[model samples]
Target: MAGSVQPRQLALALPHAESLSRDDFLEGPANAAALSLVDSWPDWPNRIMLLAGPEGSGKSHLAAVWAGEAGARSTTAHALTAAAVPGALATGALVVEDLNPSGFDERALFHLMNLAREDQAFVLITARVPPAAFQVELRDLRSRLRAVPVVTLLPPDDRLFRALIVKFCADRQLSVDETVVSYLVTRIERSFAAARQAVELLDGEALRLGRPVTRALAAELLRDA
Candidate 1:
């Protein structure tokens, strides 16, 4: 008993870099339209566009891909202000991400849209919900948001869901096979967030237990979850 080494007390929280490049993007029916719009670029139906999707639905990934190609500067809706609008669009392309009705400045956003129109700059706005759903106090801003072409990303289907599980595991450098993947696909929620979560949990548990990732390990880890 005295010579027995205790199991590792904690799993190291190692960071993993996720590629947001065009090549790393996983295309599927859920995101085809959004990907197409990002690829369309300067030829967009409108200079200002809204990308609407649920959390972890690849909205940021697609935005990053577009930003790389368009030389766009990125800012969050909460960080946007009337004073920042001019400099924000200095690159002729800007990404205003995570727009929430309660948090962002309505006047500043209105000014941004107006200035972007006048300067012919391309504005890509990302939000969890469609902008029309925002309880905007500014009538003009409301109208402007409605006029902007909306591209929505839907939940991943079976094929994409499986692909996402594999990619997420790969991102964490976790070696998972079809057995583990198949087990997870049926057990976890059908969304990007779920796949990412499942992999992170498996990775952490595997590290803590000093066990290889496999169907048996996954079952034991996820049995209570």
Candidate 2:
């Protein structure tokens, strides 16, 4: 018994955290600029504002916060069509997400931009890259997107990364320690996506093996990655 590992006694029900709300957002140096820009919306110098960031860099979460504040309707670039733009714009505040240059509808987006401007609607566009990098076939659309002010979300730093991991763990009701958090922060790549994946892998492994979340378990689960 002395040499054997002890199994953690977890609850029958998974821990439930509050829904993804603005209050849950952790604003540190990594995301403060982006957050500040988002907070300063409606008073933006330009009518169209672009939010760009790498995958899982909190762009969507921040967009959600903006949506709640402005009572905006949100959709992805692929889903935005010439036909759907009118209905989408009816919300007055609109968020068009993942507006990459490749495989996007330039005409539809151009139209949405024009409509948003005409209607005085506040538009928030999100993408993985800045609008300057997006390859727009339509010169008019290119010019339009280029004119939109851009805000970039930098990847999460250690503070934000650890906070995100803790939030992810709490969402799954996984009781992880500071040691595990600190361990994963150093071992894993510094990205929101990576943190989420690590937490997910550890949580699933712990549940499957009926073991507590430990440094050893984390090392085992993320060793290959």
Candidate 3:
């Protein structure tokens, strides 16, 4: 007994898995239009498209899907510069995400748009607010973006929320049955972001306690919320 060895408890590594495949994305009234617009690219009414949605509304995932199909380079607004425009345009397609006008570089964006037009390339712009709401000092840039077709993703419905919960759980390697799903769907905040957060908390708590995900566990986690 004195020489007996205790089992080694290796540190758990949470898997980083995010699949942006088109098939994996859930469809509903809130995001149907935005998805449709992404699928209709190159043939788009304009070279530039504005995708607006709340946080965790799947705009970035949708953008990733579109980038794959269009062979576009994906970047954020803050990373763009006048010198980066020509090289980015060489890709023939681009996706600039999380564009906040306040800290955005006006001259760089202005040149980017001009170069995009000259190259006949396509650009997808994503943000929490619509482009029209931005206070762009450059009149031409504002006009150009204002005319770009805008697609907004609204909040998820019951069906979509449930699907997201299941997806999030599965992504984190957590097995959740219908009971857990039913309980959380009714009590959790009505958003994809909330679904993701709940699953993360539950998964962490379950791992810490060596317990399975269940309705009771979910209740304990959501109780404080």
Candidate 4:
């Protein structure tokens, strides 16, 4: 019998696509406003946009989309310093994420913003809080940050959280029961990361115990978390 298409060969042949594409995102009231900004960013009237959200709120996910859409380069604030910014800013469309944590390269960031505007390129930024939260010494940089329209992703609601689980299970080809689903929706933290953790827990436990997803099994798995 002919060997079917090799998995490795098939994988390489398919074009690589954006990781957190619009299709992979979940639509719900919790994140509607932020989603709107991300989906419409390529056409945004401004050259700069800010995305703010707590951990697990999908800020990075949307930022990745912007990088792909704009064909821009991305880096953490830590890797960028004012001295290093000219080259980084050379890419008109760029993404700087984890601004507060990634070394907060304010000088580079400050210059990059101006460069983007002058070059007619887009710069997308994501952080845990609004620009007001950052301590700024550069008057112009502070004001530029303040001027950019800010988009925030609110925490996910329970319904959206559940839908996330279902999406993951479908993606993983795992068969989950309604009771198991309901149990997790209540017990897991109301966040996308929680959904991911739950799936991993369940998958591991199911494999260990050789059991199908059930309320009791979910309870057992969650209890261990």
Best by lDDT: 1
Model 1 worst lDDT window (10 residues): 5-14
lDDT for each residue of candidate 1 in 1-225, tens digit (9 for 90 to 100): 989987656998899888898999999999999999999888999999999998889999999999999999999999999999999999999999999769999999999999999999999999999988888889988998989889999999999999899988988988878899999998888888888988999999998888999999988877887
Better by lDDT, candidate 4 or 1: 1
lDDT of 3 by residue, 1-225 (tens): 999997745436577587899999889998999999988876788898888998889999899999999999987899888999898878899999999868678888889888888889999999998888899988998887788888999999888888889999888888989999999888878987888888888888888778899999999888877
Please report the TM-score between candidate 1 and the true structure.
0.96
Better of 1 and 2 by lDDT: 1
RMSD value for candidate 3: 3.0
My TM-score estimates for the predictions, one after another, are 0.96, 0.89, 0.91, 0.80
Q: What ranking of all candidate models by TM-score puts the best one first?
A: 1, 3, 2, 4
Q: Flag regions of model 4 displaced more than 4 Å.
A: 1-19
Among these predictions, the greatest TM-score belongs to: 1
Superposed on all Cα atoms, the candidates' RMSDs to the truth, in angstroms, are 1.4, 4.6, 3.0, 7.6
Q: Which stretches of candidate 3 lie over 4 Å from their true place?
A: 1-15
| Model 4 Cα lDDT, one tens digit per residue, 91-167 | 66778888773357667787788777778888888888888767788888888888888888888787888888887
Q: Candidate 4 local accuracy as lDDT?
A: 0.76
Per-residue error for 156 in candidate 1, Å, reads 0.4
Error of 1 at 111 (Å): 1.2
lDDT of each: 0.92, 0.84, 0.88, 0.76
